[model samples]
Target: MTIKDTAEEWEVRATETPFKGNKTSVRTDDVVMPGGSVARRDYQVHPGSVAVLALDDEDRVVVIRQYRHPVRHKLWEIPAGLLDIPGENPLHAAQRELYEEAHVKAEDWRVLTDVFTTPGGCDEAVRIFLARNLSEAEGQRFEVEDEEADMELARVSVDELVRGALAGDLHNNCLVVGVLSLVAARHGDGLDALRPAEAPWPARPFEV
Candidate 1:
């Protein structure tokens, strides 16, 4: 079907912010759907994020358990954080997050996958990276407090991670995508297509 589409296809009439949080904001858009019906589209506007899938010598992936108050579950997840900095590179952000959350630095870094967390109701996007050749970072000796205090990290085999994702046991979006992406890549080009460390992310929105 040769269907030509444009912003008019979305039929967005106007938009307004209802709640502006410290890191995110909620916006509602008045719009018309494809069938000429008017509607309201509400979504959270986010600045995006990065996640690191830390790999060890045994080919296991690092997983962390954290308490998510919203979901009310101490879900196991990969090391990840929001890209909240003004001009920090996403890879640098990922490296910092991996060290902060897991206290490990990787000598080899490659893009694993990029995903939109919840495109239907949120603008949150995350780029997951694969980091190998790991070692302890001396800068991670600081005392943990707040959310970091109760977090636990461990290494799980890549096969197990992929199994958990496929069996619907892994709920964390980044972990699921990262594990599957690595599995797929191993069966395919093996890192021949991994993006550079300084890959340009045009999808990351401009700061307000």
Candidate 2:
């Protein structure tokens, strides 16, 4: 049966944002679904985030080993950050994140892909960028806290990154998706086929 069928119809009633934080918000919605059944869905609302796939001259990718307290493991992830500033541009945020997290910058950038971090639980839309022509920010020091305080940066070949990701060696969603998107575009339609860094994001619900 299709979701449009009467058996799956639902209507939302009261919606409220009970908690608002710099990074997220707790939104609770009262609804009646599944043919008059009542339900309440509480979830986090995020302003969205950006992920950078920075490729150096040799085509190696920059990754970081940061501890994820939720998972209790030091996981590998690409340089990324959230869109928290009210007036900040997405491209500038991507550039800032790469520089801040990995101490690097890029001369070329494009929109590689976008992802819904988890639509079932949150409206956390994520944009992935493809960055090349990289340069190291001189004397760049990462000012991260908590689990990121002891982060270790590594540059690995794209081949290895792709293989490792495909073999389930890496766990970060952004890293896996970003790496695969770049690899495909590089060898398939070419990086020029990607959308501009300022491409419109229909899934981005927040203003900033």
- Give lDDT tens digits, candidate 1, residues 12-94: 88889999999999999999887888899999999889999988999999999988889988888999999898566788889
Winning model by TM-score: 1
Q: lDDT, candidate 2, residue 112? A: 98
Evaluate all candidate structures by whole-model CA lDDT and list the values in order: 0.85, 0.86
Q: Which ranges in model 2 have alpha carbons more than 4 Å from their true place? A: 1-11, 18-22, 32-38, 139-142, 205-208
Q: What does candidate 1 score on TM?
A: 0.88
Model 1 bad stretches (over 4 Å): 1-11, 35-37, 140-142, 205-208
The residue-level lDDT of candidate 2 at 70 comes to 76
Worst 10 residues of 1 by lDDT: 4-13
- Report the number of the highest-lDDT candidate: 2
